[model samples]
Target: EAGVTQFPSHSVIEKGQTVTLRCDPISGHDNLYWYRRVMGKEIKFLLHFVKESKQDESGMPNNRFLAERTGGTYSTLKVQPAELEDSGVYFCASSIRTSGRAGSYEQYFGPGTRLTVT
Candidate 1:
């Protein structure tokens, strides 16, 4: 049941270099989230792991942006010197369990990785 996998979809670095974006979730999902939408704003939640710790990073959007979920399946988002507003489009969502309330479920998106920092 692999429904989330993002990589090199579109990356044009230049601002400062360093860009590592990779996300693969959908196997026994334990809840993994990392959203973004620079420019117009709206989608902004760059942290939320539930397997390899980091249950909530409080929307990380600084410190060069760095996220990882090693043994938790697959999840990586590293944006080093890359600046220029960090470009946009960098989503990696995975859902399976969220308190069982079923109020905010269905998070399986992984077709984004477009970072153009010119």
Candidate 2:
């Protein structure tokens, strides 16, 4: 089976431009997550989607970032008016639905998209 995959391995945009990152998770997986490592900082969780519903989005940086999982197959993360601070390696991960422990399941990750905002 194929693992998660992200499009546009790299993107460079102006500060006020918009960039959308897409992720295709492994088939049959119901849990999807978005994460990023910015300014050389450790990777941080951005949001999570269970099927087509958002389970948690508390880690999203701000209103400028929007994430969506359409039809529960693929997910997209868009950053409007991108800022220099948003430049980072954006990662997408997926796994089977967790039952009890939150961190018990093994998540598969994509190669990640490197975004550069100038």
For each of the candidates, the C-alpha root-mean-square deviation to the true structure, in angstroms, is 11.8, 1.4
Q: Per-model C-alpha lDDT, please?
A: 0.87, 0.93
Q: 15-68 in candidate 1: lDDT tens per residue?
A: 989999999988888788999998877988879888788888888978888898
lDDT of the structure predicted as candidate 2: 0.93
Per-model TM-score, in order, reads 0.32, 0.94
Q: Which stretches of candidate 2 lie over 4 Å from their true place?
A: 98-104
Off by over 4 Å in 1: 1-14, 19-29, 44-67, 73-76, 80-118
Q: What is the C-alpha lDDT profile of model 2 across 37-104, one tens digit per residue?
A: 99899999999999999999999999999999999999999999898899999999998876776752
Highest TM-score model number: 2
TM-score of 1: 0.32
Clashing pairs in 2: none
Highest lDDT against the true fold, candidate: 2
- The clash number for model 1 is 0
